[model samples]
Target: MRIGLYPGTFDPVTHGHIDIIRRACTLVDRLVIGVAINRDKGPMFSLEERLAMVEAECRYLSEATGTEIVAHPFENLLIDCARDVGAQMIVRGLRAVADFEYEFQMVGMNRTLDPEIETVFLMADAQHQAIASKLVKEIARLGGDISHFVTPTVARSLMDKLGRG
Candidate 1:
């Protein structure tokens, strides 16, 4: 059984993120969506909240794709998480040239950390290439509708965090 790790901050799982998850599901037997805790980049939602949001979003993904998808909160190194989960591949979504550049470096670093684990990059669907968690948060904070970008649960969570709900 091939296990793939999809690690991200997932401040709130967006439709774009779900798209990638759905796409990755086709290649791997199981996909573990890792909700990484980043201290450097202060998040609008807490780690637990982010994990909860991802969990809720993934339920819809699993139902839609009929794939085994699990979300786990990881405070440790990604390499350690991959190893712990026995993941053979790290799945990433590339949205643009900038994302490619950044992910290329990360792929190299992940390879250095664990040579057995390979990083796989998937291009984001053209419609979702411009959607990002940061942008969704900013727009939602400014009273703009983000219903199109994220799931209803995520939209509500973002609104609650921004004190708009």
Candidate 2:
């Protein structure tokens, strides 16, 4: 069975994220969404809260896309996570050339770590290309409406975190 890993902080899963997950599902037997535990980046939500939100968001995806969706929180190196999960592919979403530059380097490093593993990049839908967790947080922090960028559950969670809900 071919398995792919999509790793991200997923501070809150957005509609764009769901779009990519849906697309990745079409190409892989199983897609594991790996939520990285990045201590460097202070997050609005706790790791446990983030994991639960992702799990809830993905439940609909499993049914709608007919793909197995599994959520895991990882603190180890991404290559290690891939190996542990038997993932032969790393799936990423590219929003712009900047993303390409970063993802390119990451792909090269992952290849060096495990030559058998391959990284695949998918371009985000144009509408969501500008949407990111950091951007979402900024908007929410400033009391800007983000209902259009994130899923309803994610939007609600962000609002709750900002004490606006």
lDDT tens digits by residue: candidate 2, 1-165:
989999999987887788889899998888999999998998888899988998899898899888899998899999999999999999999999999999999988989999999998999999989989899999989988899888888888998898888
Report residue 158 deviation for candidate 1 (angstroms): 1.2
Error of 1 at 134 (Å): 0.7
Look at candidate 1 and give me any clashing residue pairs.
Answer: none
The CA lDDT at 76 in model 2 is 98
Best prediction by TM-score:
2
Candidate 1 per-residue C-alpha lDDT over 1-165 given as tens digits, one digit per residue, 9 for 90 to 100: 989999999977899999999999898888999988898889888988888887777887787777788988888988899999989999999999999999888888888988999988999999999999999989998899898899888888888888878
RMSD (CA, Å), candidate 2 to true, equals 0.8
Which residue pairs clash in candidate 2? none
Runs with alpha carbons beyond 4 Å of true place in candidate 2: none
The C-alpha TM-scores of every prediction are 0.94, 0.97
Question: Model-by-model lDDT, in order?
Answer: 0.88, 0.90
**Candidate 2 weakest lDDT stretch, 10 residues:** 11-20
- Error (Å) of candidate 1 at residue 136 is 0.7
